[model samples]
Target: MDYRESLSTGPEGSMQAHQVSHFFSAVDVARRGRWDDDALRQLAHLAIPEGLLGPRGNLVRADVTLAQARWYLEGLVDYAAFEQDESLRFGRLALQLWQALVAQNPQIPRDELHEVALKLATVAWSEVRARRIRHRARMTLDTRRTLWFRELDPRCYLCGYKFTAGARDRFLRRSRSPLTPPPLVDFTRPRTKERHLLIEIDHMQAVAEGGTNELDNLSLACGWCNIVKGRRGSIFDVDSRPIGMLDHPTLGWLSVPQPMWVLRIVSMRGRCEHPSGCSANLANSELLVAPYSSRGALNPANTLVFCGEHDPWKDERLISRTLVV
Candidate 1:
């Protein structure tokens, strides 16, 4: 039967069965000592398109692609030693092709690709987690301390209480002073069971969940919040309401009672300010001042909103001249 006809006539479950059957048959051939350049090339022809292409010759649905990738990788996880390596080779090739498909198709949402990558990374979950921890540890003590204080303001991002100086000093000494001898403790004070400020660098998306170790993925959270948010992803429980006001430099605190969601969509889709307002849509624009940073911290101080065409960050002079004034 033609591939297209097979796809249409067979139920979805049956189509998936055919795909898996073809995949494992290819894998089994590789298991037998037939795994070679020509063998792999032929298998690639069968597997890559079967995994990626839909009945209409376009990429498969994101959900279908994700499911197939997960199924194949799970199979790799169970393989015996020699077979495991060959299966891994096949899995990596499949992933590379999927990535290429994502790149070629503008309609494909990148988030779906990221989700797939995250799933594949789970095959070596412990290694990825360890690597991420090591990567974070490799940051200079000074850099880490600076980022902690600057980004977190000596306070927990989740809870607003300021970290005590003693707590801060102890944290710095323990975390940064790797070479120095441990500081002597003063046992005299009646140590009440107060919550000492213990800060942790958290991955907002989590390393195990395919979050990168990039600075953009890192954020400050107290030990309490970090522990609570462990591996389940960020807990955005904090209120995001716009406090019914905006602090304009010239206008002072104007009572702008619009909800943040309304403002964000309005900024993206709203008309320009020119007398004969340009018809160009700013639907894809970011807020001049993001309500939240990419790392997920709220930024109420980000008062200036802008469309894609009029980015405040790009035009520093415009920000100073117009927004500041």
Candidate 2:
């Protein structure tokens, strides 16, 4: 942590700032010193945020095998740092140092960071030195594996190990260029509208039974259908056309084929959710209106959209419709 001895004036000699080169040299000396965990912890706490540490406390953990610490430090330098005026030999040396550490680190096992950087640097150098042969396939696979783990669950389904979200995001941003856009609907839409519409995608077929994960398999169901279908194949009749299920995305209150009667009902009633077991009380006049009528059909296309819940007094009615249906 005390870098006083590590400091020296540059060639012009006016109290030279410690360059990354100087920091790395000091770190090598520190790694050789017999510093306890408490001393290492203090060094990490003081050094990292100021950008003195390479990243992930790699320099501070002197007890860690030299090979492992070097891998992380090397991986930290990417295209942006590569663009700087630093020597090209520096990058090459850093990666080589990391590879040496990987071969040497026993306490801290070689992790994915080492594997990726080694592969990428190897391919990059080969392309530059060996007549530009295409060797990006391995790099692409590694990148894809990184992305899948980010989007999918982090812990291995078979084995449990914590994965960092920050690491995933960094990998995604670097590997895929601009990361994939956020979800389709922004959750921050204003609540003041007359009817706030909630779009939920219901799978046409349950994914558990050979259904592919794609946009086509998705259908926008209103909040009611989304809640009702939770984690189970929705109830469908003998023809395989879903019964007791709303065609949420494509046909709102009516079937996908578009029944004329249902469409007319939906046009007047907005999206209707006749909660299960509620016999249509034709006697209730207040319940049947622009955003809350029971007359809408079960098709996806005819389903209503953008209707915010406006009337406070009718909150009970809205919940009943969406939840029970």
Candidate 3:
């Protein structure tokens, strides 16, 4: 029997499954979108091949032929017909298409172009293989998601909007399939609308930016916020800082490092991270979690929270030991 993927239904789950495979070619594979914000309003119909997101209905991206792009890629490396590795096939194709799109921008050095192209290609491969990747570790993924959902039915870590449970289940279900285009929901309406009410979990650190699946690297997000936040990925930020911000309730405004930096800043809400139950409050503010020595970059995988009293930073020896490098 032949198998095929299905498009999302209009909230009814009755969409017919066609063996449709779209040939996506883009002028900006990484979606650099390098124009002024006003360009969106002023030039809505422009097709910026060098530095923009989509073709703006001009289909600037769709014009590139995948076969021609593949030929260009073959010029760069040893041509491999019927390459056994699926990732190798798709990734190089993505790179070639990026090169083809950037043909007019000859000022970009080939080395720099190749580096960025590979980064973008890697993201595509991760998403394309997300189902298979998750299936390999589905048990662990589901367990973490289940436990995470049980604790938070309150507020979005990013926007501080209070919501109900079950979004975890919804998001997990959605993750099992290919990425879907958002519904034609008008976001300008009230926050209580169906789109605004849906909550989804997001990576505190992006996959393209070397973020892992550790607990510290995950946070709850409203459906809309997650889409807006995760849209550009880390392709824009060179320093690993998130381009998104959170207008928190008590904190006024906070930079969304993990979408839940508000909660993380308080060090597990001012409690000790001890394995055994400890009534001690985290008063010292200075906290520590390991995989310690990095080249000036913090790793969210080993992040921990604590309140004020546990001044772990005071211990010069413990601090030194935690530094792996």
Scored by lDDT, the top model is: 1
Candidate that would win on TM-score? 1
lDDT against the true structure, per candidate, is 0.42, 0.35, 0.41
In candidate 3, stretches whose alpha carbon ends up further than 4 angstroms from where it belongs are: 1-153, 165-195, 234-325
Report the C-alpha lDDT of model 2 over 181-254, residue by residue, as the tens digit. 22332111111211112333345454433343354554333332334344433112112232343323322442
Full candidate order by lDDT, most accurate first: 1, 3, 2
Clashing pairs in model 1, backbone N/Cα/C closer than 3 A: 288-306
Question: What lDDT score goes with residue 313 in model 3?
Answer: 29
Alpha-carbon RMSD, each predicted model: 20.6, 25.5, 22.3
Give per-residue CA lDDT, model 1, range 31-83, as digits (tens): 66474776666576764434233221221234346556545654534323323
lDDT head-to-head 1 vs 3, winner: 1
**Better by lDDT, candidate 3 or 2:** 3
Model 1: residue 168 alpha-carbon error in angstroms:
1.7
Q: Estimated TM-score per prediction?
A: 0.29, 0.16, 0.27
Ranking by TM-score: 1, 3, 2
Lowest summed lDDT window (length 10), candidate 3:
316-325
